[model samples]
Target: MSRRLRLLVTTVGLAALAWLLLASIERAIALAERFEGLPQGVRWLVGGVLLLLVSLGAAVTVWWLRPRRPRAPVTAPDRTSLEARIAQLRHDDAGVEELRSELTELDRRRASARTYLAVFGEISTGKSSLIAAMVPGAAPASDARGGTTREVTHYETSAWGDGWTIADVPGSAEAGGEARERLARAEALRAHAVVYVCAGDLTRSQAEELRWLGDFGKPLVLAVNKADQWTDIERDQILQHVREQADGIPDAVLAISAGGEERFTRRLADGSTEDVTRRRPAQWQPLRDALRRLLAAGPSALEAQRENAVLASLHERTGERERAYRADEAERIVSRYARRAIVGAMAAVAPGSDLVIQGALAASMVRALASLHDVRVTDVEVDNLLRQVRMTLRTGTSVVLAVAGNALKAFPGLGTLGGGVLHAFAYALIFDSFGRALAATLAERQALDQADAGERMRELLNEVDASRLRRLADLTGEALRLRHEPSD
Candidate 1:
């Protein structure tokens, strides 16, 4: 009801109470005057009975209408507090459960996606250029401002077979930036192998890149670009430079020319395939060979590309959901808190907690139980649990209240039984106790969720191979875990 309407009703009720009190007083005064004028014998009995009834009725009315105070609102967690909580959750048992769930899911998706052969190298090394040409097609042309290909492109060719996904990320600088982000995504995707590309003469920039990322290192497939343009002297010099770049790699360097040599082939309007082999422009054959070796080691490359495409899409959506769940954790806890408070306040006013209180308690209990499970929690998830609690509590309250009303009507206890104050007190005790207990229980559950969330994150991180992910999976696995896990 509107505040104005509520205020008006309260005033009316107060006025009625005052009028009834005044009437009783007036009746007593008149009776006293009558008894004073008549004999005193009959007056005592009538006066005593009237006073007792009025007193009892007044007490009952007060118990029914007295208001309970409102509860304080729950605030968003503090930044430092939230951070600490996130840290703490990482170390707990609940976190381990969460990690197990994420790891299992990631393992399934990675195998399904067949994300093998990640290309890692410095900018303009023709890493993108090479993958683009070999796959279904090239990435969409872009201005490439500041040499940043921030977009991690995926190329799929169903003709290759089932379950093939090829991931192409921005080139890595030893400094991270776009390449590092790409690598993180790659790790999540679970790429089976890595193809590291280095272009031209291989500057010191190439040597330091791998060492800088230390742990993010991957099995290297060193690809050298612009081999076609080099003279014999230049080739020797380049080969020497490439050796330094390959210093840390397990395999040898693979060279390719981004530009064709003296020979060139072009499609004519004749719609016929013709071979006019000029001196092979920088041959991508070396790069191609290395890629094939990677495939030979595992599943079909073509199928991997195709599967990667679909899995990439699913990974994204699921990741988004997980992040949201993490953020919503606090809200879920607060909701249960509010409901419990409501019930407690109601119980305080009513003697016994209403049907709403019981339903709320039950719902909170069930939700707390579920949050403890291995299943990932999200805001939508917890909200659904609380919603059921509310609905059940509301229904229960109505039923119980109705039954109580019927019993009261049938017995008419207030009219002739022991004082109503005793009944009011009893009802109030039940209601208040239920609300308090529910709140206490909900508080405990919230603590558990808050504590467990981080451990789960750590578990996920541990399950993924940092090197494998940095090279092949990119941020796919990270995305999946963040998406599935709820924010609290």
Candidate 2:
């Protein structure tokens, strides 16, 4: 259906559901006296029918509004097709060499980069101050007031040589979908170490978060906040909670008070430093020790010493080969056919066409692409393919917000210069759409070259905290390698 019609149906369906629910309640109230006199069997039928209709209507309405996708499972790939694609990728000999070279350079950089350290703790605690103390020019710690720190901040660390970064993610107790997605993306794309932070509350919520972090399969560290003023009773409860939560993860918790000016400047005798060690209570010493232990020995430090020697060699041979595979499928095979399928969808816009011609355009586009590629285009894929193309086009191509701004100011008409302005925008869109489709098709597999190394590196990093690791990624060649630099 057209977008307008689909929206209309949705509005109508919602109205219908509300009407049904309200009507059912009213009918039952009206029949209250009669209901008491009627046999139980008839009353059951009336109530059951009302509920069933409402449930069915709600389900359909939900399904209608959800984004559609091709029926294919996102994770599945048939071996035979994969093999065929791989076999074909061998032809791009020169481009493969260039890709290999780039991969080698990146690997060399990553392997030697200084690791980052993160200071994580929940609201009103002092993660901000902890980082601030470790790095000069860092912001002073402040009370969160509530679950406020909505933005993730980064601070450079003195301990992780140079080229290391520490990222502080916003803390949330009841994290929803966006929170999960943001954290997961940060975990996948950036976090070098994982610090599960919690504050004053020694309740079950902290236990739940800490418990899940245990299984994240990283070098887990717990940052229990506000230890300075913990009563003996609260202290014991907090320690017990920490011990139980850290179970299975062979790591220790860090304790430091980022609040108060004195604690903010507290320095340890060991090579390590604290943002607010002097101001917090004594229990935090053990946590600082745990943070120290993480950097003491591991493959991560060894890899940094050697740089990217092994991975570089591997990429020099395999890098470009992967990109060629994606290019073949997307540019030559998938997108070429996809455009044809989309043009076919235009048939629906033709006035007074037959029902099949008008309605099947959307369905036909999905089926045609799958058939041409000799692949199964699942229902989910059907819904998302065009949308994916459109989304990619919007981002991969420059938006030229400047042009959009001008057009809005003019506010041209349907048949006037305004019309011409719309045409210009339309032209820009067409160029962007076709360009993105072609480019994404070509580069879809480009990331495959780094996927393994990225995962391996992230695994090592996640064993720690993101704040510190990001420092490593963001620095220049020289700053990332020095280990003895004095830290906060």
State, as a TM-score between 0 and 1, how close model 2 is to the true structure: 0.36
Give one digit per residue, the lDDT tens place, for model 1 in 1-488. 89999999999999999999999999989977887776577777777888999999999999977763322212233334433334434354453343334334444654555545566667767766666555635443332122223465555544344545555776656464764654433442345555666666566766665443222333346667777666877877887777755454434575676553244567779976666765333467766676566555455434443234324423443344444444355345534443343324422434233435444454454455345322445566555544443444343544434433433343343313332322332232223223333333434444334324323322322232334323212222223244449999
For candidate 2, write residues 7-80 as lDDT tens digits: 99999999999999999999978888787777899889978998999999999999987764422212223334
TM-score each candidate: 0.34, 0.36
Cα misplacement distance, residue 116 of candidate 2 (Å): 1.4
TM-score of 1: 0.34
Candidate-wise lDDT, in order: 0.48, 0.45
Query: Which residue ranges in model 2 land beyond 4 Å of their true spot?
Result: 1-112, 136-152, 159-164, 173-189, 200-216, 245-250, 261-284, 298-366, 369-488
Compare the candidates by lDDT and give the number of the best one. 1
Off by over 4 Å in 1: 1-105, 113-115, 136-150, 158-163, 174-189, 212-217, 260-282, 299-488
